[model samples]
Target: MVVYEGSEEQTNRIFRALADPTRRDIVRRTVSGEASVSELAAAYDMSFAAVQKHVAVLEAAGLVAKEQRGRERIVRGRPEVLRHVHAVLDELELLWRTRMQQLDDLFAQEAEADAATRPHDGTPPPPVP
Candidate 1:
């Protein structure tokens, strides 16, 4: 469970969590609406223990929360955790956009340099004939 100290490891954990299919499914299910352990487990072919482990990983990441009620555990996804993932992605997108713009500017500069270095005769550099 990361405490949001803003360390790189914690940042990577969010990415790692988003990488797993089962975890993503669990998040999608819970985010749309809450469900119980049995309900969630039944949706998958894997054993209950396997599903429980997935749920545990999600809970540890603070992506989901579990509550006990009469021996049934109800699970719900936390949107804020998903929002954190979105924020990281958004930041990365901004960085890439900035980098791409810089590359484009460099390309334009190179074109200008080529034009300046070329002769203005509007003719070939002299054919072999």
Candidate 2:
């Protein structure tokens, strides 16, 4: 397993927050531009309070920022946090790729060893030591 730069709790919160489809959509929308709580709620079929809860989850994950612009609660994506998330994902990818390469090398070594032991002609195989 790859150890990420952030704390385990924070990572868990981030993953848990993003696991929801509604929360993911909120992040995507806010990342592109700022949106008010009411505006976001209008786009979805759920009640405004439900959308607020989704936004709250994203906020707790540090994926988005919420600010009060008069009566409206403005929500915007945090690029820096997203960058950190991207880095974590990159690390995971690197770890998996490295593991895959190691597996490939092991397979190649096994194939070479098998080739060495097998008789080219129709003779019996070599006895194990």
Candidate 3:
């Protein structure tokens, strides 16, 4: 099987980080533009420490990065990580589509073989109730 750029562990971390609603929102917000840690904390009802934890998870997953500017820590989204995610999904879709086409071809072949084996009498088979 063809694997995407990241290792399995890294992919797992990325998915885990995105599993939380708060973390997902943080990513969406930061992707549009960078935000200060305090700003992100203020958006949520939770404590600043809770928001910090969310940012830590995102940073660990490589989905977001943090930079220090004076006394504030700025968080920015990494669009390239999202692109990697999309690439993996696209590959899986292609694999699934290929499998579905193979199944269709197999069923068609079976039907054709069944028809060939059937009698060529003028009368057709009774309808299935």
Candidate 4:
């Protein structure tokens, strides 16, 4: 199982919003710049209402911001949330590197023990061709 090291509540909301492909698509589309609801709706096969709902989920997660225009709502992707996600992943990476170093040390110790058990005097093993 994979563990996430992020704010339990906030990360839960972020992940929930990202779980849907349509919502993820909406995010991708807005990365270039903010787009109106009708403009975003045209990019996907889903109904405009469905795309609006996806935008709502992203806004709730603070992954996107929606501004009220005269008629349409403009949705923009918030990249800062993704930077937070990257930071959490970096923390997990540090934990994994520490674990890997410990495993490497254990393997080296086992190799030394095997060499100690070799026949004849305790001399270094000949280099392999």
TM-score of each: 0.87, 0.88, 0.82, 0.78
* RMSD (CA, Å), each prediction: 3.7, 2.8, 2.9, 5.7
Q: Tens-digit lDDT track for model 1 on 1-129?
A: 324556776667666777899989999999999999999999999999999999988887778999998999999999987887887778779999999999999999999997787779886554447
> 26 in model 2: Cα distance from truth in Å?
0.4
Comparison by lDDT, 1 against 3, better one: 3
Segments of candidate 2 deviating more than 4 angstroms: 1-6, 122-129
Model 1 poorest 10 in a row by lDDT: 1-10
What is the TM-score of candidate 2?
A: 0.88
- Cα lDDT tens digits, model 3, 1-129, are 436677899998998998999999999999999999999999999999999999999999999999999999999999999988778788889999999999999999999997886778966765669
| Pairs in clash, predicted candidate 4 | none
Worst 10 residues of 4 by lDDT: 1-10
Q: What is candidate 2's CA lDDT for residue 73?
A: 97
TM-score of 3: 0.82
Q: List where candidate 3 sits over 4 angstroms from the true fold.
A: 1-6, 120-129
Give the top-scoring candidate (TM-score).
2
Model 3 residue 123 CA deviation (Å) reads 4.0
lDDT of 2 by residue, 56-110 (tens): 9999999999999999999999887777777788998999999999999999999
lDDT of 4 by residue, 7-106 (tens): 5787879978988988888888887788999999998888988888889889988889999999889999988887776677788899999999999999
